[model samples]
Target: MKSEDIQIRDPFVLPIPEEGKYYLFGSTDRNIWGPGTGFDAYVSADLAEWAGPFPVFRPPADFFADTNFWAPEVYARGGRYYMFATFRRKDNDLLGTAVLAADQPLGPFLPHSGGPVTPESWSSLDGSLFEDEAGEPWMAFCHEWQQIGDGEVCAVRLGADLREATGEPVTLFRASEAPWATPYVSPRYPDTANYVTDGPYLFRGDSGALYMLWASFIDNTYALGVARSASGGIAGPWHHQPEALYRNDGGHGMVFRAFDGRLLLTIHAPNRTPDERPLFLEIEERDGRIALAGRTSE
Candidate 1:
């Protein structure tokens, strides 16, 4: 499949060294006409030609299907690949993040836990995992502004089994708290400043500086930014830089090393609501910070 042939938001690619191929996963929809369905995974060897839309996951028989299925990211850990994704519940009108497990990257994934890592009562989404220096697991997720008014990013310790939350989730920062984040003002909510919090992925810099790449709107345009953890840990006093990492109305980014050992960031640019394409850019670490090195044709 060509890049435009694949319709997805928050595209994540996991390169399997043993197979010499990449597994791609994201939201696959029929049209921009209704709520999102489940996700699909595709395999590619050269990042140009794709092989399978191999059914990685779909709503189970009689499963909750009306609400959105958004931002599915796969991570390989401890001999198993795990998928962290966002799902909303129609029965209670609540949103949360859940974990799925599989033996392979392009998987017939199975729900490992009963539900989300965040509490059922909280309206949360975009949950991602991070491992600290001591090899401790942590989940950082967003508390939706639709329910809280000001969206927030929260973190909590994950149990060893990766099935349950070890403790309560702590508020890390609000969407409005970042110096670079702007409020979305539309006629829908005219009186107040509406905030949004989207994807959050953790990366430990080569210099041991911990950072987070998250998405939000700046002047109602989609953008991605990076924040540094002062303590070099997940539970830290994070400080947001004054500028965004990518500001092309695109976001929901993840950092990975290319097959050739160069650092790369993958995100969808020109972030139209329903139709978006995966874009990869070369990135470099300079002075313990990340920046756009260039764009790659690959």
Candidate 2:
């Protein structure tokens, strides 16, 4: 199948340089709000052509979460692959991120954590793994604006095994802190408006600068913004760029280096339910910040 034909959201690409393959995962269930199904991944040798709806993760019958299995990001660490994804239980309204394990990138991933690692009281999602220079693992996730009037991007230290939170979450920044982020008015609560913070992916530039790619609303449309950490760490005194990195109604993005050493940004475009498809754009670092080069021909 072609990438443009795949229906997905929160698009994350895991490029396996050794295998020369890319694995794509995201919020893929047909009815995202209903009982959750498992996650499916597509493999590609080139960014254009893809294969498989390979079932990388399927919850066991006794799994705690039955809906909102979202934003599964696979990372290779300590000789094993770990997945950081979000889930919500029917017994409770709170949604949080969890850690899963698999022997391979394209997995039969199984739950490795005790349960959702984010605070049970907080509504959080889109957890991405970040390992510090000291080799400590951390999770950077969004504290959803649905619960808080201004959504926040926060970080918590993860245990060595990648299964539990080792420290209290530190608020890195709020959606309102970003000059480019705009308020999104809730349809259900017309009088209430909130700033949104979605998908937080961390990147360490070749220049040794720390950067974060997070999604929010600009002009009431889904957009991706860039933030820089002056301290070169997760606990950042982050500064937001004046404008969005990508603002074409596509977001929930993650960046990966292609096999040929090209920096690529993967995101789901159109920002609409059921019609969203993965879109790839070639990106380059310019003046210590990310700039869109052009869409990848492949």
Candidate 3:
């Protein structure tokens, strides 16, 4: 679809080879009025034009929170599709990530777990699941900076069934530790700087180099940054890249391969809350690092 035609943030596309179609999903908000009715998916053979805004998920009648249903990422694993998404609780004013399951990419996904994965007391969101080499699942999530001055990315082991977290979440890295990460600047906090980390995507390269693409703001512009797992595993001794993967006013990136064997990085740029659209960029790996090879719109 044309970039302007699709209204979404945190754009996620899943290619179904069997159906010969690609499904695109994201957070769709008409305006600042309130949360969108539900999550929708669009199908396409080519990325330029889309078919339908098919409803994949909607809040249940007894759903907890109506607002702040954000960042839905669908992953196909072990014959089922699982969605990791964030929701805000009405009672406590806390945000947490929860898992939902369905049989297909465009799903009528329903909650699979009993409740939120992050602890009830702490404010967390944007939870992404990563499976390590040993086939054990792990959740890489963000601890919101609003609750704490410095936002943190953490990892915790997922239960064998992928329904719950097994132990206390371990701190992987703080947003401020990365050279490319910048803090949220506001007149409210004139003296103190608070870092914000949103979205964490983990993928292992064909060459066996482990990499993660995450989002943060830099100099008031949304940007994407990368970090490498030096131990060649998801549970890293990760090394932050000296430079970010993309620094334009865009972020929240994910990597997927085209049918033609080319690696592509998909992210939205010019990221304003009400004006974000999907953009795809060709990518290549060199010297154990990934970089933008070309822009599709070029």
Evaluate all candidate structures by whole-model CA lDDT and list the values in order.
0.81, 0.89, 0.83
- Which structure is stronger by lDDT: 2 or 3? 2
Ranked by lDDT, top first: 2, 3, 1
In order of appearance, the predictions have TM-scores of 0.93, 0.97, 0.94
Cα lDDT tens digits for candidate 3, 125-241: 889988887889999999998889898988888897778999999888899999988888856676789888888889877797999988888886788988899998867888888
Clashes of each: 0, 0, 2
Worst-scoring 10-residue span by lDDT in model 3:
289-298
Q: Please provide, for model 2 over 1-298, each residue's C-alpha lDDT reduced to its tens digit, 9 standing for 90 to 100.
A: 9987899989888888888888888889976767789999999999899998999999998887988889999998888889999999655878999999999888899999988999989999999999999989999999999898899999999989988998899999999999888889778656887999999999977688999999999878899988999899888899988889988898888889888888888998888888899998888777877778752111
CA shift at 110, candidate 2, in angstroms?
0.7
| Runs with alpha carbons beyond 4 Å of true place in candidate 1 | 31-33, 62-65, 294-298
Residue 81 lDDT, candidate 1, scale 0-100: 88
Residue 65 of model 3 has an lDDT of: 64
Best by lDDT: 2
